[model samples]
Target: MTNIGGAFRRNINRIGADNLSLILALVILVFLITVVSGWAGYDGGDKFFSWQNLMNSVAQAIVIVGLLAIGETVVIVAGGLDISVGSVASIGSVVAASVLVGVGTFGSTLLPTGNVVVAVLAGIIAGMVAGAINGFIVTVLRVNPIIATLGTLAAFAGIAFLLAPDGKPIGVVTQPDFTWLARHRLFTDVGIPDLNGSAWTGIPVLTVIFVIVTIIIHILMAYTDFGRAIYAIGGNEVAARLAGISLTRIRIGMYMISGGVAGLAGVLLTARTTSGNPINGVGLELQAITAVFLGGAATTGGKGTIIGTFLAVILVGVLNNGMNLLGFNTFVQRVALGLLLIGAVAISQWRQVREEKVRARALALQS
Candidate 1:
């Protein structure tokens, strides 16, 4: 009992009070939302906790946000930020959809069907190229990350709009094969029946993809040397550089990964909507950053967990779902999200200050 208690204490110490408080808050919020949802019901149907709704929440609302959040987490942990992920995603969607359908905005066929794979590759490459540009601007030109990415944000979005002028949506909406990327299910009508004849269907393919991505990222962040270097650089760039860590290479690579993932997210968005809307990814960057920070990652960087991010995304999804069920307007929802982002950053900074004070006192006592 003593050993187990000691281990528990050590784990808490490792996580720190801020993260512990955040976790508790998440649990409480989830509990309250679930209880209220059950009590209030949804759209006159007593189905707040239904599996169908859960699946929809994960598949439609959460997956893309989660992916973007994961990429943002990487950059944030590496002591940088990319505010242009949304714009990059938008460009990726426009390009990918245009290529996939082999048509330009004016409905002219630009590529053959045999080039579908190449088209997808082209879209991803476009995103990576944008990321590389951001990286070059920041590392080579020594521009601030926030400013560089912000500039790219506008540039990328403008490019997307230019490609699909007047808010046009590209791609064949009625093509089942193209739409299957988002609509396909891992299982259908294969159910586990109880003695009372109750049964459940299954999860969406997108949800599965999201889960796999999360797991892979969790491992990469937790177990890789590259991850450690990122954290080190975030914690203290000079110290990391002295330790032989290549800041330029690492930072550029981080941005590239961020852009690449955002591109893939754009593709997924196109799949889900069956149309590549140039404005599709607008405001997503804010949501992704909000999720990462809310997950207990510091704005100053060097500390965060993939699990925290995953939970944060789930929390956001639930909040959005709950708000929809409560009949709130989209404007109100946006306000709530903006406030949440500010609050998350405030809480994270406060925790860092508190930890610094504690460490100072400890050092003084030792002296």
Candidate 2:
């Protein structure tokens, strides 16, 4: 028992207390959701716990938010914030759809695949440009991150509406190739006997993309000098500058990355809805920011993990899915998420205080 206890402590220290807490909360929430689902007559919780739902429903549903969270993680880690990502996504979707409809028509007679590539490029580029503008305002113009992004949020959203005809959804149903990202699945013929002996359609392309992006971001943040610079800047801008880290360049790059990812999410959104609805990503920035904070990213910046953010995204997805199954209204769901955000921020502030106290005590002892 002593040995086991020691091993557990070691593991906890390695994984971090914040991450462990998130895991425990996720497990408890799952159990509660299952019990509630059973009581609600959802076939003993199968509605929320089934394999099909996990893979097809929940995984697919979280892709957009997950992507946004990943980008937000980078920005937050670099000592900045971007509340304009959703608006950037909206802009990307509109741009992608418009390009698809226009170029797709012309390319249909020539190179069929060319239009899809062009449309995707246009969307991503639009997002990156929007991000650059945000970075410029914050770094060059000396605007606060919150105010700068908030301004862009409104501006970009309006731009999206203006780009769309009559301020409405641009239908992309006719562009089947463009929507393939949302519809395609791998291994449709693989039968899993353990899963009701049915052929598993494998994972959705969108989910696969999300996983890939997560892995890439994780590597970028964990194993690169660029990532370390970001951490240094977030932890202490003055110290980092003295250490010769270019705050302006790194922060701008981080914002561009965020915008690029948000743009990709926008493209995926267009694929999923088969339309470029200017309002599609209206409130998604809130969810993404929530996930970043809830995943243990410091509100003051300088600390976070891609893995934690990914897990947090899953937790949010599960919570939303379970609530929907239980017939909770959207308004109630929004309130719950708002509460979660508040709790996450509070926890982050507490952690920061504790760390500061520990450091102070150590410095005093050394003196």
Candidate 3:
């Protein structure tokens, strides 16, 4: 019995203080949402989680923001940050919409077939190109990651505006029926029915995409040699370099990965909106950063997990949904999110300090 109890405690410690905090936050938030959701007149069920509205809203936001958070995770794990990702996504949407609809200066009929697959690829490539530019600026010119990405954020958005300088959002009106990309579902109903005896059907297509992306990234970050290199670089650049790790290549590659993933997020965003609004991704960087931080990723880098970020995404989604359902002001939600980030950072720092002290104490005893 003691062995089992000790193992459990050890496992909990291994989860890290920041991660444990997130788990606690998630549990508390869910409880509050469930209890107070009734104040908002939600009638779907006793618990807020039982409400379809809450679930759907969370699902939608998670799919959109989760991908962006994943990209942020990759960058942070490698000791960098990319604020321009939101802009990359914005530009990607613009590029894909323009090409698919054959509108603006690009001319219609570029994809006369309105081929969604082609449009998606175009959007993704646009995002990647933007990311590559960020990588070059930071890795080659040695600009700070934050500064480099911030510059690109403005630049990318400006270019996106140029793509549709008319200031009107590009819709799929002329594009070949690509709306289904966002609308399609998979394994909709393996034969489950609701309490009302209605058939429960397909999960949203984007949700599936989010899951697949999360699983793939989790594997990459947790298992691969590349993942180890990323951690080494983030944890101790000098030692990693001495160990033969190419700092420049790794840094550049990480930014590229960040940008590319952000681009893919843009394609997904385009599908969701069915239009390319240049401003669609505005402020998304903060949201993604907040989620990553809340998920236990340190701003200083070298520590985080895909599962942690994924949970953070869901947590954010639930918070947003619950707040909206409760009729809280939008600014209140923003403030709350900001506070969460601050708290997460504070907790992380505290943990670091505590660990250092523990190490020092052990060394003192040995001496």
Candidate 4:
């Protein structure tokens, strides 16, 4: 019995204090934030994590942080870093919104669903194409990732401005296919003789779509050879190249992934907000990157988990929700977040350093 208990303790400790600490910190903060969330009148009525409010918070987190973290994860795992996620997300949304409007003016009853599907697909593809362009400049042209993305970041935003210079929002009239995304799906038992209760609980279809995309990404990263290659290259691009890995292809792939994921986020945002702003995601990049770092992505690259990033998103969502509940000042909120990010990165790095030391010492002693 003692041996078993001791063994379990040893295994737990091996998981380390750093990760454990973050998990605990997040949990404790959740409760505290929940309490504060009530005060924000977040529901426009109550001091509680009402199902609706909680769902809203989750949706928002998935939209904003999801975009940033997804890109950050891809870049970090490819021996690169991207700080232009926000602009990319905004640009994608604007383009999607524009496309939706263009299709809606068709005035055909059958056009709505087809148009939305097409617009979403095109948006995702466009995002990937944009990311690929960034890769071309960074990898093929040998420009710095940060510098390259930053340039595109500005250019993309400028393009968005040009796409809607007058700041007019596109709607069904722009194409005849607008209402379906807002209200098209029907939920009922298959022509049942007498369906009990309204056969459908009304909810946003986009939620299911977003969750599905995240799941697909998680699987791709966790179970594919290409995924492992991503980590290997990110961990050491020179070593990867020497081992016959295609650094160019890997870098390009990561950027493409970043753009594609951002496109999904863009769809969600347009759906939720019912329109796209020319400057909707100005600081989202920083916040998403912070979330990735906070959730324990290695600054040196090649070390990150989708699950960790996802959890980090939830933690951040709770923090924001809690702040509103607590009636905290908006300005002070971001300041506090900044400090937290710096502190979390410092602690995570320290933990990594300690682990390396311990590992080295163990190996040396064995030798």
Candidate 2 clashing pairs, residues 3+ apart or interchain: none
Q: What is the lDDT, from 0 to 100, of the residue 68 in candidate 3?
A: 90
**Per-residue accuracy of model 1 over 244-336 as CA lDDT, tens digit each:** 999988888888878887888887888888888888899999899999999989889898877788888887887777677667789999999
Ranking by lDDT: 2, 1, 3, 4
- How displaced is residue 340 in candidate 3, in Å? 1.8
Model 3 residue runs over 4 Å out of place are 6-20, 36-47, 105-113, 173-177, 195-201
For candidate 2, what is the TM-score? 0.92
Cα-based lDDT for every prediction? 0.80, 0.88, 0.79, 0.68
Per-residue error for 189 in candidate 3, Å, reads: 2.8
* Candidate 2 local distance difference test against the native: 0.88
Q: Which ranges of candidate 4 are over 4 A from the true structure?
A: 2-22, 34-46, 103-114, 165-168, 171-204
Query: lDDT score, residue 256, model 4?
Result: 87
- Looking at candidate 3, the ten consecutive residues that score lowest on lDDT are 43-52
What ranking emerges by TM-score with the best candidate at the front? 2, 3, 1, 4
* Model 2 lDDT per residue over 323-348, tens place: 88777889999999999999989999
Give the TM-score comparing model 4 with the true structure, all chains together. 0.81
Supply candidate 1's per-residue lDDT for 242. Answer: 100
Q: After superposition, how far is residue 307 of candidate 1 from its true place, in Å?
A: 1.9
Runs off by more than 4 Å, candidate 2: 1-10, 36-44, 103-114, 194-199
C-alpha lDDT (0 to 100) for residue 279 of candidate 4: 74
Each candidate's root-mean-square deviation in Å? 3.1, 3.0, 2.8, 5.7
Report the number of the highest-lDDT candidate.
2
TM-scores of the models, in the given order? 0.89, 0.92, 0.90, 0.81
TM-score winner: 2
